[model samples]
Target: MNVTIIGGGAWGTTLAQALTDNSHSVLIRDINEAFVEKINKRHIHPFFDIVIPTSIKATTDLDEALDFSEIIVLCVPTKAMRSVLVDINSKLTSKKLFINVSKGIEPETSKRVSEIVNEVIKKKYFGGYVVLSGPSHAEELILRKATALVAASVLKKNAKDVQELFANEKYLRVYTSDDVIGVETGGAIKNAIAIVSGVAFGLGLGENARAMLITRGIKEIVSIVVALGGKMETAYGLSGIGDLIVTASSMNSRNYQCGLRIGKGMGVEEAVGSLTQSVEGIRAIVAGYEIGKKYNLDLPIISAAYKVVNGQCSAKEALTSLLGRSLKEERYW
Candidate 1:
């Protein structure tokens, strides 16, 4: 299938590179003119030495990218999804599959990226929709690490197109799921938990604490997932279990690193400014809280995360508060 990735950030750049070598006609769109020029000239994003291809056409025009496109990959940052979709709303034509690789929730709407798109991106004009998510990290994928991911879509053919298009030995292993809601929710919620674990690490907490947090976090997040109409089992699959493990444990995770800074006594704005990349957890934690309120669910950990990042509580206090919460039966209802 012909593909156009809708953002030219790190993940988008890596994906374009991977697909171009496979004989796919790939186009990448970015609002940044410098990014477009750099990729066309150097086959790399100016931010990093990315392994992109000269043949992978890069443009600043969404209309240009959408033209001759059968698959639209939503590769923008999680927080940027809404504004970008709103801008591209009129351009989304029918018969194309939309694949989201971004991971987080829409803060104001408490909607996953796909949900935001579905609500705003008039699907009747598009070819199709899909979500590609899993343990795969952009940096690791660029380095050609063996990565496993799922391409979830409401339409089976879109998922299969992604699977057949992305599978290879060097990079981007693909799987498919019709449970797009579950896969999308799992991908968004796990980053919030990863921030909690990262705070645990930065506070000099031991593995016992981090491990317990990570494991129980599974239960905590799964509750919200099932309550929101997602499959309980998807939480255990690549989009769920796979992503949670990677985000919570890896130094490469912006969310994890952001939490570490907060745990070390830095302010949220300061920590966020220190990093060049946007962290998904900053938005995910807040969205998780908003979601909890709408669903009337008790999410102590996520609640504490909101407090910690906003400076309402210190990391130690947040951890203590979580431990001090009222006890209840461990149920997954």
Candidate 2:
């Protein structure tokens, strides 16, 4: 299959390499001309240590990327998805599939990536849309490490096509599901937990504290997911608990780092400035807060995360409040 990865960031470029290895022709498009030039000429994304094959075409033009590829792997971040989808919608014919790898809710509407795609499709032409998400990250995928991700679509056939698209011995293990709500929810909620875990690490809290927080974090996430029309079981899968474990435990997670900075007594603006990449949890917490309110979900952790990020509360205050919560039964069920 001919594929276009419509972003030039690490995830997009990394996926381009994976698709190329799968014996599919891959092209990557970046809005940044420097990133485009670097990938086209050097075959390596400047953000990573790995090198991609020069055979993968990298360009800045959307039309050029769309011209040959039938399946577009939308790897851009959530904030950029709207404009990018709008640009691509007119050009998309009925024959193509779009697989979203980006994770985060649209800030204005608090819609998931799949929702955004559905909205795009509703507004104009029809196209196959699916969201491929899980604990797998760009770093692991690019290195060809063992990884598994869900191929989620509203239509099972579209999910099946995505499963076939990336299933391979060299790169990824793909699972198909019509549970798009669960899959997308798992991807979005994990980042907030990761931020909390980051704060624990920065505060010199032991692994036990982080572990406890993460386990409870999963419970909070499951509540919100169920409240907002996602399956509780989905949170236990790769995109759910799997994602929580990876993002919360790893230093590579930008959200985790952002939390760490806040825990260390730095302001949100200061923390954001110190990091080069955008910390998506900053946006996700805000969206999650809105979702929690709209759905009447008890999401104290998500609320705390929003307060810390938005400067309404300090990280220390957030942690203290979490620890001082009213006694409740601990039910694993």
Candidate 3:
């Protein structure tokens, strides 16, 4: 199958390598001329040290990419989702399956990527929307390390189709889920928690505190998932708890790294600007805070994270605030 990936960043370049390994022809559309030339001319990923397959190609033209294949894999961030979809809709000539690899709720609407797709794409041109998310990171995927991800959609067939497209017996595995709401909610909500986990570690609070944050963090994730009409069980599955464990604990996560910088005394703007990648956790913090208010859910961690990231309080102050809350029974179920 021919696949067109719309972004040429780390994740986009990483997926291009995976697709080529599966013997699928890939065309990546990115706005950076040097990045596009590097891939097309040298067959090298701009962000990683690994060399890409000669079979993989990239271009700067969105129209050419939209016409290249029926399978459109979106690797861009949530902030760029709407503009990219509007461009695709203008040039869409046939029904297309959108496989979104980005995670995070839109700050303006707090809508998931699937919702944004439906709002922008024409119904006649929309075939399906599948969200691919999990504990997998781009850095590991580039090395063909063992990775598992969930392909979720309301349509089971769409989910399975994605599973077949990315799954393999070697280093990558894909699971299908009909709980799109649960998968997307879990994927988005975990970013906020990951930031808090980073802050905990930056403060030199040992593994005990990290474990506590993750354990309590699962409750916050479930609350948002249930409020969003997602299944409670899905919160414990790969896209939910699985994703949280990986993202919140690792240095590979951009969100965690951002929080670490903030905890170590860097300003939020400077901490975020230091990373070459998009820090989805910052926006996820804001979106999660708003969702909590809209649904009237008690999300202490998310609220504290919001305050820290927004400059309303220092990391230590936020930690103190969290600890000062009235003691309550542990209710994870």
Candidate 4:
């Protein structure tokens, strides 16, 4: 399969490398001319330390990328997803399979990446859509570490195709799910919970607090998933609890790092600015808070995370607020 990846970030570059190593032709498109040139000449990303496969090509032209491949993998950030899709729509001459790897709700409209893609692309030009998400990180993935992911689509065949595209028995495993909503919801909101876990770690809170936050966090996630019409059981799968555990516990997670800085008394802005990569949890937490409000759901941990991330309350205050919530009979539903 000829694949074109639309972003030059760590994840995008990693995917390009993986696909190329699998003997699939890949073209990476990025706005940065220097980054493109670097990849083409050196097979290395300026930001991430991973060595790209020599077979992969890089381009600054979106039209060229769209023309080069049957499958387009979108790896841009959530905030850039709409604009990038709109650009792709303008250049699209025919139907193409779109696999979105970005995870997050649009802050302004609370739309998922697939929703934004559908809104931007013309109906006649639509081929298929698939979301690739789970606990896997680009850093680990590029090193050929074992990773599992879920490829979800309304159409099961499309999901299976995606699974075949990326799955390698040695390092990568892909599972298919019909519940796109469940998969996407798990992938997006887990970042917010990861930030809270980082905060707990930063505050010198030990295993007990981390366990508490993770347990309650999954409940918050499942509640939103159910409200959104996704299956409750999906929350326990690779895209849900699996993702939450890896993201919240690992220092490799940018969201967790952001929270760690905040927990150590650094300002949110400072913490965010210090990172070389985007901290998606900061944005996802706001969207999660909005979703909780829209659904009239009681998400104490999510609420606290939003408050802390927005600087509306200190981490300690947020923790206290969470602890002070009125106790009810414990329920997992």
Candidate 5:
């Protein structure tokens, strides 16, 4: 199968290598001319200092990329999703299967990438939407390290199709799920929790604190998933607790790194600005706070993260607020 990947960034190029490894043709479309040239001429990752497969090609033209294949892999950030979808809609000529790889919810609207795709893309040109999310990071994935992911869609066939497209015997493994909401909710909420975990670590909190945050983070994720009309079991699966465990505990996660800086006395904005990559946790914090309010749910971790990001409280103050919450039954729905 031939696929066109939008946004030739870290994850995008990494997946391009995966596709080529599976004997599929891959074309990457990125706005950065230098990135395009690097991929096309040097066969190297734009952000990472690693060599990529020479079979992979890149272009700056969205129209050409849209016309290159029937399968479209979207790897851009959530903030750029709507504009890119609108651009694709204008030039889309036929039915296309959209595989969303970005993990985030829109700030005010709390819309997932799938929802944004449905709202922006014309129905006639839309084939299906599949979200591929899990504990896998692009840094590890580029090294062909062992990773597991879930391919989720309301359309089971679409999920299965993606399962086959990216799955391999040695390193990459994909499971299928019909619970799109659960998978998406898990993927987005984990980023926010990872930041809190970072804050815990940066404050010189021991492993016990990291464990507590992850356990509570799972509860928070489950509540949000249920509120969003997804299965509770999905929260414990690969995209939920599995993802949170990896993201919140690792230095490789940009979200965790951002929190580390904040815990070490840097301001939230400055910490976020210091990273070269997009920290989805900031947006996830805002969305989670709003979602908690909309559903009238108790989300202490998310609330603290929101306060820190919005400049209402210091990182340590946020931690204090979380610890100061009244004791209650450990019931997690």
Candidate 6:
């Protein structure tokens, strides 16, 4: 299979390498000429420590990459999803499978990645859309570490096809599901919860506090997922609880690191500015807050995260307020 990855960031480059290892031809498209040139010349991503496979090709031309593959993998951040999809849609002359690996809701419209794709790409030209998400991170995957991810689509066949496309028994495993909403919702909102977990860690709140945050965070995620018409069971699967566990516990998560900085007394702007990579949770918290408001859902942790990250409240204040909320029976459903 030929695959065109529409981003040159760490995740995109990492996927290209993985595809090439699976004997699939991969082409990477990026707007940065310098980055593309460096990858084509050195087989090494400028930002990450991983080396790109020699078989993979990098280019700045969208048409050339689009024309070379039957499957287009989007690895760009959620913020860039709209423009990237528009560009791809303009060049698309026929239907092709699209696999979105980015996780987040659109800040302005609060739409998921699939909704943006559907809006940009006409239905007649639509082939299939699948969201590849879960606990897997680029840093671990690039080193051929064992990892698993979920491929979700409204159509089960589409999800299965994607599962087969990237499945590698040794290093990577792919699971298929028809719950696109659940998968995407889990992937997008977990980042916000992970920030709360990081704040706990930064405050030296101990393992119990971190555990409490993780458990309650899943409840918040499930409530929102169910409210948005997704399966509750999906929230317990790889993309939900699985992803939350890994991201909240690891330093590799940019969202967690951002929250860590905030808990250590740095302002949100200063912490965000200090990072070289995008902290997706910063955007996710705002989106989650909006979703909670629109749905009339109770999401204390997400709300607190939004307030802290936006500088409307300090982390300590937010934590105090959260603990002071009215007591109620724990509900898993």
The 0-to-1 C-alpha lDDT of every candidate, in the order given, reads 0.83, 0.81, 0.91, 0.89, 0.93, 0.88
Best model per lDDT: 5
Off by over 4 Å in 6: none
Candidate 1's displacement at residue 284, Å, is 0.8
- Name the runs in model 4 displaced over 4 angstroms: none
Off by over 4 Å in 1: 92-95, 326-333
Residue-level lDDT of model 1, residues 13-117, one tens digit each, is: 888877876889888899889889888887775566764667888899888888858778889887788888887777755556678899888888888877787
Worst 10 residues of 2 by lDDT: 118-127
TM-score of each: 0.94, 0.95, 0.98, 0.97, 0.99, 0.97
Model 3, 1-333: lDDT tens per residue?
999999989999998888888889999999889999999999888788678888889999988998999999998888888998999899999999999999889988999999999999999999999999989888899999999999999899999999998888889999999999899989998999999999988887879988988989999999999999999999999988999999999999999999888888889899999999888888899999999999999999999999987789999999999999999997876
Model 6 lDDT per residue over 105-219, tens place: 8877778998999999978778889999999888888888999999999999999998888989789899999999999989999999998898888877888998999999999
- Better by lDDT, candidate 6 or 4: 4
Candidate 5: tens digits of C-alpha lDDT, residues 184-250: 9999999999999998889889899999999999999999999999999999999999999999989
Whose TM-score is higher: candidate 3's or candidate 5's?
A: 5
Query: Which residue pairs collide in model 6, if any?
Result: none
Error of 4 at 180 (Å): 0.7
Reference-based lDDT, residue 79, model 2: 85
Candidate 3 segments whose C-alpha is farther than 4 A from its true place: none
lDDT of 2 by residue, 143-196 (tens): 899899898888988999888878887658889887888888778878888888
Question: Best TM-score goes to which candidate?
Answer: 5
